[model samples]
Target chain A: MTELEKYIHGYFGVPTDDLAKIVTFFKPVSLKKGEYFLKAGQLSDRLGFVQSGIVREYVEANDKEVTKWISTKGYFVVDLASFVFHQPARWNFQAFTDAELYVIDQKNYQRIGQMVDRWHELEKLFIAKCFTVLEERVLTHLSMTAEERYQQLFAFNKELFNQVPLQYLASMLGMTPETLSRLRKKSF
Target chain B: MTELEKYIHGYFGVPTDDLAKIVTFFKPVSLKKGEYFLKAGQLSDRLGFVQSGIVREYVEANDKEVTKWISTKGYFVVDLASFVFHQPARWNFQAFTDAELYVIDQKNYQRIGQMVDRWHELEKLFIAKCFTVLEERVLTHLSMTAEERYQQLFAFNKELFNQVPLQYLASMLGMTPETLSRLRKKSF
Candidate 1:
């Protein structure tokens, strides 16, 4: 199986060759560190597959930015509202590290939806994955104390903690870096 | 189209015939006010589609019950984590009014996913719809003030607001009924 097929299987566990045809419409592009894959008010033309490096998604509210999601290699990131609605995005996507992305536009996405028998299954798998992650996040914020959240973050993905900036990581954890620092020190 | 097919089509926008097959797999059930369709720590055996009446889903946090969602007529109500994972539910689903629900068990649900072509389309549509709604809820709770979220809830579904209890609605809005009342008075 190709890299594309491997990713698809990782998502859906479907190995039909017809699935490979769905990947043909995607175009690959590189994003520099600090560059945006998508910004507020611009349509997110595609859902991006990360081949390497890190990225973050954020939304501006009440004159402050709230980090919503962070991604590294073998992950997908996009302003879902814009991609699905074909409207201007309210969120922004930025590369925290130089990144390689394979992107599929809305038209081709819908084409694959219509033509591929397994596409809906794959879509369900993708949605389920997103929901599972989001649910875990909500639980963490709702139930855990801030310090506990920070410690869990440090334990689960030390690479993410090292690669992403502290402010952004703190934002994603729904805490301040000073608080994060205290917790990290408490841990050691 | 049958009554059941009509309701299914309204949620999924799929063909009536496809919905008819789906309807055959569902059992219609009714519950009186104050009754529970599901409870915490029980295995959620079925998913319910509300034809009429009200249901509220809540989880116990900090020894206080927090309502996560309120489903009225034409809404789907289930403990998704429990139903999907075959585990004990973390949430409670209780009827706020006499409720008519269409129910489907896990076996039929898996069958629908594997066998029906249009069912696949409908499933994707349903997942996408759920994702959009959940995403909006997360954003609204995170960004909007409690008063703003309450106002938006009433604007979106005044019928639900009128029928659901004040305490439940307040929980969903992340405020006390007294606070919601103050906001309402301030708005007028």
Candidate 2:
């Protein structure tokens, strides 16, 4: 199975027939480094799954960019609230490197229910997983010390340390780059 | 239809048969003021719909209580992540006033699938609504000023100003009670 397919199975565990039906909607797409998949003020009409490369979600704040998240392979990259609810997009979703994505447009997304009765069930589980992940992220930010966040991130995705800018990671962790560096040195 | 039934219809608009089936699992329960529905570190085994009165979700932080959310009549009250994923709950769910609730345990919640195929679809929409609400809250906290947060809360739920303690609301809004009080005086 493809990485995207594997990730979907692992996360959603849809039946074989449903998985086949779902994968047909995802169209192949590519992005050059720094090109935005979705920009602020636009309605997000599509959601993409990262097959390869890096992408970042960020907002302009106090004359600086606040990174909301950075995604690599096996992640869905979208201004999810905007895509799901038809709201004006809040974050700019830009490729941090040349990237390959499998994207589903809004029209096809809506048409899924027409194809399968279990679509809602699968989709509900999909959205519930998203909610759970966000809940964990919110909990971590609220309850964990900055150093603990740094340690947790480092342990989970050590490749990000070299591949992505330190400042973006720091901002996403709700801390300064200097603090992350200090923690890194102490750990080393 | 009862208030909880009305809320379920307003929010999900499930078919009459499915709605009736869904409601059967929810047993009526009540709590006096200061009674806990669920506390931190416990597994959240059930979800409750508020028929009347108020509920608060909070966590102990820095030797103080930090209010995460307050739910009134028409709201579903649970540590959502814990309820969905079987994780240890991080928030304490308690009554802010004497409350009447309609609750469904995990077993009954799982039984919905066997009862209706469309339950997942309706449930997915229900969860997506929860995610959208959380997204809005996160955006407000990240982008809005403390005074703006207080003003918005007061404007939306002015009754909460009297019904709930200012400190709880203040913490929920990510502010100090003093700041909330100052904003209230300025607005008055």
Candidate 3:
């Protein structure tokens, strides 16, 4: 099975027939490095699951860009608020490297419910997982020291340090780039 | 109809029969001022919808108590991660005032699926709403200044200033109590 199929099957636990049908809606799409998948203020009508490379989600605030997340292989990317609520997007999602993704638009996303008998259950679980991940980030940000945050991220995804710009990782960890550099030197 | 009933009807949009059946599982419960609904390290087995009064969700981190939220009437209170994933609770949920709630235990929460055909759909929307709210909080914290955060919260819930300890509000907004005090004097 493809990584996307494996992820869908593992996470959602859909029966083979249902899983096959669900996967059909997602078409393969490519992006050049620095190309935007979605931009701020536009409605996010589609969602992407990264097949390869990285996508960065960031927002411009007070003339500074704050990195919200970096989506890598096997991770889904979207401005969830805009995708779910039809709000203008607040974050810009751009490819950090030439990338491939399994893309699904809103219409097909809705059609999955009609196609799969347990779509609602699967979708609910999917969103709950997202919520849980976000809650963890909030708790870490509120409670952890900058060095602790750097250490935790290093332990979790050390490759991220090499792949993304240090400044983006610093912003995502809610620290200045200089602070992240200091921690990196100490850890290394 | 009670406030809890109205909330269930409005947020979930279950049909009358299903709504009545769903509401049956939630029993009325009360907490005295300073009483705890759930405490850190315990598993959160119950979820409560506040009918009146305030409940604070806070964590002790780095020897300091960080208030995550202060839920009031019509709001739901639970360590959502613990409640959903059966993890040890990280936050203490205590009544800031004598409070009444409509609560459902985990068992009853699970049984709602068998009782209501559209339970999955409603539950998905419920979680999606929670995710969106948290996303907003994360954005505000990342993008807004301490003063801006103070102004936003004050505008949204003016009564909270008089109702709870200023320190708790300060902690929740991620500002020091002294900073909050200074901002209050300026705003007033």
The numbered model that scores best in TM-score is 3
Model 2 lDDT, residue B84, Cα: 74
DockQ per model, Cα: 0.34, 0.41, 0.59
Better of 1 and 2 by lDDT: 2
Residue B135 lDDT in model 1? 67
TM-score of chain A of each: 0.92, 0.94, 0.97
Give residue B53's lDDT in candidate 1 (0 to 100): 83
Full ranking by DockQ: 3, 2, 1
Q: Give each prediction's root-mean-square deviation over alpha carbons.
A: 3.6, 3.3, 2.0
| Candidate ranking (TM-score, best to worst) | 3, 2, 1
Which lDDT tens digits does candidate 2 get at residues B1-188?
A: 76666788888887776778889889999999999999999999999999888999888977878787889988888877688778898889999899999999999999987887667777887898888677656556445678887888888988998989898888887767898888889888
For model 3, name the residue pairs that clash.
none
- What TM-score does candidate 2 reach? 0.84
Stretches of candidate 1 off by over 4 Å are: A1-5, A16-27, A107-117, A139-155, A174-188, B1-4, B82-88, B110-116, B158-162, B175-188
Lowest summed lDDT window (length 10), candidate 1 chain B: B134-143
Runs of candidate 2 with Cα error greater than 4 angstroms are: A16-21, A60-65, A110-117, A140-158, A175-188, B16-21, B61-64, B111-117, B176-188
